[model samples]
Target: MSIWEEHPLARRFWKEGRADFPIYDMHGHMGSLNTIHLARAEADQMVAHMRRIGVKHLVFSHHHALFEPSFRNVRAWEICRNHPDILRMYVAINPHYPDHIREDLALFDSWKPFAVGLKLLPDYHQVPLNDRRYEYALRFAAERKLPVLSHTWGGSSCNGYPQLAEVIHKYPGLIFFIAHALFGDWEGAERLVRESAGNVYLELTALPGERGLLERLTASVGSERLLYGTDLPWFDEYQVVGGVLSADITEQDMRNIFYANVERLLGRDW
Candidate 1:
């Protein structure tokens, strides 16, 4: 039998979801996308899903906010406001619109506890994360020590490891969450975590699908530097949770990944 077969938490999680292990999903998305269909993309539907899976908190960016040129973050603000108990938001920053970035940052504080940080989709936005256009938002996040979730991959010119390296070093104070953990390049992801000074975190969204990636990452960087993320509406929460529970890591490590690390990172902010 495998190690997880006899584990109490794993057994309970398999039987009744994780009622005892409350999760704080650090990376998620709301709203429907243009390219693909998402079954539970609405805020209420997502909240229902979270409750079913024992997810205590979720910080997400609306899909429209990331992809639409005209929409920006208006829907994100509205949705998060309505679901304040379980939802938080990332103010989406599109580098193409400097005015929108400035306007959003200017009004950010007013959103208060609802707006936890900023989201950068550099690859989709066609702007490198290290570019001058993103400076203002980066500077703002750094100054306030707020978290910034960037969509990073292995070899894309926009938010790839090279660009991330520059910005992470430049804005050390910024709590950086590397979305997808640089995707395909596992070695690069491990190196990025090893090289960074605690400010950088690897968010597990689509990663749990890979068999031993979680265990490997835990071994390399420890659980404290890793964060749980569902990429909700895009993936099933049970599958992600099962992946963690099934890993060879200890319960404490599971706790850290599910909620503890995020609680510490957000502090009293959430």
Candidate 2:
């Protein structure tokens, strides 16, 4: 039998909606979008889904916070405050509005542990990840040693491997979560994790669908560097949870990817 065939966690998840495992999803988005329909995009619905799947916590940015220049992150803060047990938020930064970025940063500490870190979508915002406009946010995060989740892909100029490499080198103190694991470039993802001096993390948002990729990453960098995430509302929680549970890696590695690593990063209190 395959490893997961006999695994208790796997069997439990198959039977119950959840398992004994504690899942901490590091990447997710809330709210409906103009382009696509998100069935369970509301905060309450997302929290319910997290509970059903044994997710202990989720750190997410709202769709409006990322897409609407005027929406800012107040709504995200409010939602997180309402569901402090299950949700934390990333202060979304649109490099296009340096003033708004500054304002948000200035009030960042007020959000406390609820505003866990920052989120960057360079591709959607039409700027490179390492651009000057993002310097303030990067520097702020680096100074405070905050986790920054950035949407990344393989070949795009905005938040691709090259741009990510530059930012990683420039801000070694920042705990950078490379969302999507550079999408199509698995080799680059491995190399990036191998070369980093321990501050870079590969967040598995859209990556669990690529069979064997998780095992490859776990083998390459160990599970300490691999973070569990599902772009919830966009992706199914059980599908991604099943992906990790069924991987060839050990249960300890699965624990690290699911929650231990994130707990270490965000701390036990968070």
Candidate 3:
């Protein structure tokens, strides 16, 4: 065998192929422009790409649904139902719609059988990370033992690790996923994971330019607290996949970051 073929992670990404180590995509979206790209068509496209690259499952939240809330959630629910084995949902929560918070949580809870977690975008909504409104969803997730994925940036005014720390402290039972590795604050993201409660996990979706980030994070925080995700429709999957595949970590660390950590959040045996 060639030297490259001898490396476990290299073999998984190149030689051995998807059959042996299928990827579980932690973040994705159903194309928002339903008129031009229908939900089923978007689902088909996502599935085709997954098959092409050996991804067996996807835990996704719809882009439009994240903003539209109730209306698009029903559409997302239907799409998940159509591809039950391959697709899962993240109930999108927008704090701007405070009146809809409780009602939307109830609806999302009812679909708990199909959802993997909840997706929050405080930055997009122009809401602070520790806003009182989000506590509604946080409380719900804690009670149900569901994970929450929130958009996090490094130096943004509202939604970043500093604000997120408060939420993590308040609800220890709820697992919090810091989205996009602090939106490129690799070191800060690692520190957040280090200091936060066990329930907090870092989502690894940093771009390729941030070289050695994955290796550093794996060393500092260990792989158990890291989860792999590709902010799919907004960012190319190849970039996200390449970031992890190029990391100078062990095959087992790759396994933990790519799949095992997420399964842990879902309370599934890995």
Model 1 clash tally? 0
Model 2, residue 62: distance off in Å is 0.6
Per-model TM values vs. the true structure: 0.96, 0.96, 0.88
Q: Of the candidates numbered 1 and 3, which has the greater TM-score value?
A: 1
Candidate 1 residue runs with Cα over 4 Å from true position: 1-5
Q: Ten residues in a row with the worst lDDT in model 3?
A: 32-41
Computed on alpha carbons, the lDDT of every model, listed in order, comes to: 0.87, 0.89, 0.74
Candidate 2: TM-score? 0.96
Model 2 score (lDDT): 0.89
What is the C-alpha lDDT profile of model 2 across 78-192, one tens digit per residue? 8988998889899999999999999998989999778989999999998999899999999999999999999999998998889999999889899999999998887888888
Residue-level error in angstroms, candidate 1, position 197: 1.9
lDDT string, candidate 1, 4-50, tens digits: 45888777776777657568898999888987789889999999988
Q: Residues 120-201, candidate 3, lDDT per residue (tens digit)?
A: 8888888897989888888989987787888888887677767877888788888888877787667777777777768888
lDDT of 2 at 177: 94
The RMSD (Cα, Å) of candidate 2 is 1.3
| TM-score for candidate 3 | 0.88
Which is superior by lDDT, 2 or 3? 2
